[model samples]
Target: MSSYLDGGGGCRKRRRGGERIFKFKSFGENGCPVEFDGSFRNNVKALVEYGNLEMNLCNDGVLCWTFQLEVHRHPPLNVLLFVVEEPVRASSINLHCKHCRYVGWGNHMICNKKYHFLLPSKDTVASCFNCDETNSYESNPEKGKLNLVELKGHIMHGVFHSNGFGHLLCVNGMEMGSDQLAGYQITEFWDRLCTGLQARKVSLCDTSRKRGMELRLLYGVAYGHPWFGRWGYKFGRGCYGVNKPIYQKAIEAIQGIPLCLLNHHLSISNNEVSVIFSRYQALSDHSIVTLGDLLHFMLKLRSRLPEENITSSCNPTTVETNCRWSPKRVEAATRVIVEALKNREFRWVSRQEVRDAARAYIGDTGLLDFVLKSLGNHIVGNYLVRRCLNPVTKVLEYCLEDISTVFPNSEALIMNNSKAKPRNKITKVQLMKDIGYLYKHILNDQKPTMSTGVLSAIPMATRIILDTKFLLKEYTEEQLPIRGNSFKLFCTVTLRNNEGIDEGSKKPMLPYECVSFNENTTFDELRQEVEKCFREVYWRLRSFVVEAVANMSVKGSDLVVGSVEMGQKLVFIGSNDDQIGSEDSSGTGIVDCLCGAKEDDGERLISCDICEVWQHTSHALANADADALLNNIEKWVVIMMNLQRFYLGILHIFTCPVVRNNVKVL
Candidate 1:
């Protein structure tokens, strides 16, 4: 567990001399384990400048943002979960956490448990927390501390305990070392006297004796070396016996394993695949419904495997039977699978792929039983589908609500990123339900329910915004997806000035709306939606979300959006007489803070003699460096006095001859 030392940041309450104190708290192993290091001002600046803005596009309009700061040592390791009221406001945000999760790389095999189980420190201080009086009766004075081994009865020696761990194991004939006998006697005698600290109901040896392959499943804590390989050799020394590859490989994988299909023991006999399919067909009588139902039932049984690290390019090893599966070849196969899925050529989930993942995660006994049960208690099907989903959008979904405006930045609790194996906890039915829930929120303007991922939300939002008009009609959850016939998606995809804006003859489009539609109404449609978001949303807003205060009267408009730029424009959309939409600015539509706005004085309201448009003097002077805006010298005299007045923050309109001649304010 990491512990944060002395740290500070640019606190809201800065000291008299402009000194900012940034304080952070790290939780220890008991609940708090953290450490943070960074420049205070630099940290605040990054968050304020580049944070992702998030908002709930519901009637109960909410707004918020997330800020991430990279640790100096590891760029991917982020330190703060800074959630804020608004993206640009640093002082009004909440600091969610002060520590970051470790990124366990360079290890031969990175598993999920790496994040949770930290190695015990050599300097571990053991004390009796359960006892009121921890002091010993003896005045030895060194009585407060107890050794970890003393507090916990004993460490369970695995199948083969060599070196430092040898004393904890008992052997049949080899003379028991004095130290080994001493430990065995103490453990057997103290089992009743020990507390609940390091107690396990049963030991691994009990299971290992009945099933020796149990050691193969301990790759997580194992150094991945076959320290127990010699123990298996005790059963035989000849090539006809345990010296064969079958006996040696499991132990070798626990030690010197290669990265290949054979190493994973995943290849199936060509006849095996046929046998499985034929058996399954016999069981189901070729009925698609029975097959589908069985598959569905079996898929739900899949569970997460912590030890597997699958990438986008991973595939089943069945194809590698004749040839070797090098990492490169495996990657190529993975790409082919992805492309096939993208093109909708065929729907497939590799049985071998699922099996290998289960093997990596489960004990040999459980793996065998799971495989058998998946095959319907017979040797029918061997596919594992439980933890099949991955966090593809790859980030947690966020929402903004009204409170004291507390923004808690919660980085993912899991340290593993996209490289980790996909989750098996969710099923297709559950995923579709989540998507449908969000879909209803998008079209009906109803409140959104919490979802599993931001990836799902992004495309749902993109589709909702892009297909607004088609969705104008009220829809039942069942009535959704207006399939087959193409409906216009008012897409906001920008075309360069040189490119054609109109889509020739494909679909008619309203000029103001940004939308698009597709024939696909299933989950795959989400992938397209994510693509659209990357192009339209991620680039435009950096990330896709905003602040929405619960119970706080959401202002600026009748409708709320997740965009700052769009929100600003929409706020002025229907305001016929709002101060910012006064008739004086007439054709200007809405004020462009970046450009400037005009007043209706009809005179001395700074006018560009060249372009003859109303302009701010400060803006004109600021752009004098550019040859275009303030081209000639004497032309400046026409608006010189008005420019200074405008610079002084006065909004008095001298006049706009374009719309009116009267000095309205005067």
Candidate 2:
């Protein structure tokens, strides 16, 4: 589909009125005689087919000559030198047009040697070019002369200057790229070995600090590599874009310091590092700042200043120091940490500062000591860290809060009362808010709805948490109800007035009654109501039979309810046909099948007494009754299936298409 300009500046000859005027252009160099292959028509046909364009070939059985000019020599096709790919099939054409030959302006010029021409795979040779046979050919096509300027604009934009791109897209604001930064310096190499830490820019008065970036940037940093400093620039230039080998090598170089060296005789265990991570679970739970960031910062901090007033104890009781960012914030957070530890609420602790302190005090091994200081114990810190690190659980918790807080703020979908209220009082604006609230709530609930509850259930207040902002909005707006701890906002109920259908004709009947319910009601309750509604119909039909056919033997007087199927349900009665053994003279007899039975004679009935008695042997739909329904089934099973399907709001079974005759069936 994508065609490149080729051959004689990609000149396309146009035909007028479905006819082409035969015209030929000539190329050669410096007084050399060139031969024509005498198959120009065939070659022209091949060219047309190859280019997927339709054109007619002209052959009046006369040799016509065009202007002769000097141009670069075209290369010969070497079949043995070519390696073909079955799928791509892009065979190399060795167009060795290094120099052109010019010959006299006679009708035909003769060369002393034979020249092999390189041609694209088309059977005909009509449009083929002839070459002088003087020179020996090699396989490589680079030997040919090329006009590089023609491809310059195609490869890169005219204004593309590497230095002009000021910033690279980041998780937050566009960060200054290496090209834009002084000396294009990449300060540190962060690899998989380093811990990932999260840092947030101080927010303005109007915006919240916890707002997430619209897009995430997945980056790997490695220390001490030549390319490390130019990562931003190289990435911007798209240099190692999707080439796996180049990208991997660059990534490896970025991880400058080998991970093995960092792990050498490290006193603190990973478990200790994990504890330090857990202390600030709420903040890190959403986007965890890796320990690597803190470790790197600590290393830089240590290098910046000589160790002074440093305690000699490996695990000192306590140390007071500035936080990672500011001394004032650190002091405030330290007090909170101490209080959190005293209260045994480990979730409130800040692990980043503690980790930095631990690394400084005991060479990263004292991380355990720091966590224990905040957590009060190693076991508790580990447990707390695990809980905070679970992103899935955290996301679910956030969604629940988001939904509950906004639920009361949602506008009502007024079905019954909306019409009664004046148009001005309809709260049209609230409708949009309600729709937004419902959309978010449903989207958030979709995950839990699809999942089995047992897997994600937690003892903590993991469910139904509300966002304070949304809660306040709901309170001020008077949009939703204060329903229990979870706000109960009223939603307009949809009233479905289902029509009945004809029995014999099986046509849909008109609207009989309306059904309405709260939007918040569970699906199971809805299913139960539908089952009950269908069961009423089933029972009514059974009663009709009991009254109409008194001659037949009857089972239990009471009706037994069965499982709720799609649209209909099955009911059973007491008494197996075999148990009664024979029909009693005083006992009842079956007059006719109440279920549209056919007559064998005018007076005599065709209904079997055994079948009538045994039809509903299961008096109760208990587990034991399953066996009775399984035995001695009736032809009406299909009808029951259809009825059940109709009741369940899904009745596609009756419309199943079957093949018949020789024609296809719908």
Candidate 3:
């Protein structure tokens, strides 16, 4: 047991500055084991600042955080009960207050025999109401001071003892509706006893009877070792073989053993057996000797015993086996297997690779099992069907609520609108089919749940945005490569310009959206062509045609137009009104109604401007032999269209002054 020094201030009610004091009561062995008891202030600064930001896209944003600091004086406890017989109802046992109320499959009662076994100290008697002369000792102590061990003398088997445990009551290794032990210092006392028991059991085993007799005779006289204070070896050579009487005698003589001589066995002369004892002892003059204290001392000596033994006759061995087909070679043969799956490449891994990983992951049988399972499934017919159906089902179900917002009329535009409906109304059969499809197709059995599929996609979406941004920067700098003489570059330039003005196109554009154009023209020719297209497009938007601009983006081979100058030059010329119609507009329609009847002045219809500027672009083909221009013709066309409109509406009007004057005359 640990030495407990008197904590000053006995039950003083003084409160330190800024510290709140609560009633402190200790009923267990060493009183309250927790040394520092203070309430903590809850802080929320982190939550306020960046709580919703995630470490990674796949991670959840932190919502809340809390931490508490406490000073404790006792060691941690490890408790296990070895039941030896059928249980009874009213069996007495010691149990923690919390465990006594546990209701679960493994819940059991802890026997409380602590109070009866260990004699109470003076303070305990003074605190215990049962010991009072007025009580006649007929009844148990007050409920608060009830000792589980003295409750009902229950028969317990293989129960480990510890002091300072808080218990309500124990029966059949189960709580009996009340605590039997309260505030007991069980952790420190129990661990010390266990350590001592282990040391004694292992240290006292005799290989020969001579050694045992020698120890017994030597212990017949009192000697001292730290644990048994003035002990004799009457308990025999091996500590385990000692009887209770010999055990007690040896304990008494242990204190005489010198600390320096405790580690080595005493050498006996031919005339007499020499027994060395250590002056170092468990119980000093200051405190009363307790069983726990003695055991603790014994354990300290046992622990200091050296580990040295000579053994001969065993031969070293090595194992040799062919592992050519082992899963241990999975990584080494990864490319081989991957190509094999897609019928791409096939190669065997060296035997050495298998040996290396196997040595490292000695007992990882599960990895092998998983590999085999995956390999076996590769040949299954349902894999493809499952993959396809699972995702489709999952996505549809996941978006159901969002989809429902479009409803009745909104449902008409869904790919499978006939089945789309609000959740509660969705039938079990439909739900199962959708869920099954999603699990099979979209998630590919990797993430069978709807939530998981959505979660995995979040990181992917973030990654796409980052990738698009990188590609855009590279394209503008004309540092990216073009594969061939295709219209890919031109299409990207067009879409990139389009995307800057279109709010609907905020999502990264897909590869299929770009249009390829001819590459034979010079950069100057392309600039002129673009200007022409712009002029043509300006005049086309004469009415309040509020058209929705959808996704316009640059992708592979189209990065040639990623210049900041090019980005700023692109312009959208459409009505500021809200008369937009859906591209796939069956379910939803837009209605533009000017609620305020007061008409705006016709001055609002000022002539739309079309602007033009000549810019040159240089194309560098990665493969000079192919000489692919990878034209930016479409973007050139759109740009020219807008510019042409601006020029025609302005410069061409100068060419036809009467037509412009008629509008002014009105």
Assess the local accuracy of residue 178 in candidate 3 as a C-alpha lDDT between 0 and 100.
17
lDDT tens readout by residue for model 2, 1-666: 011111222112221244222111111111112221112221222222212221111112211121211111243211100001111011113111101100001111111111111111111111111111111113322211111111111111011001010111011111322111121111221110011111000101111111121000112221221122222212211110112232333222222222222222121332222222222221121322322232233323333433342311011112346323343332333333343333433322234433444343334343344333433211111122221221211211000001112113222112123342231121323322332332232212335432333212111001111110000000011222233332221111111123422222232111111122244443334333333332232211111111111112323332212222122211211111111111022233332332221211112233354665212222112122222322312222233334333432221122111111223447
* Per-residue lDDT of model 1, residues 115-222, tens digit only: 000111112211221111333414432222222112222222211000000011222111222212232222332221111111111111111210122222222113
For lDDT, candidate 2 versus 3, the one ahead is 3
Alpha-carbon runs more than 4 Å astray in model 2: 1-220, 223-228, 231-337, 345-666
What TM-score goes with each of the models?
Answer: 0.15, 0.15, 0.14
lDDT (tens digit, per residue) of candidate 3 on 75-114: 4211211111111112223223222121110112222221
RMSD of each: 35.8, 36.8, 44.1
- Candidate 2 residue 434 C-alpha distance from true site, Å: 55
Q: Candidate 1's error at 497, in angstroms? A: 99
lDDT of each: 0.23, 0.21, 0.23
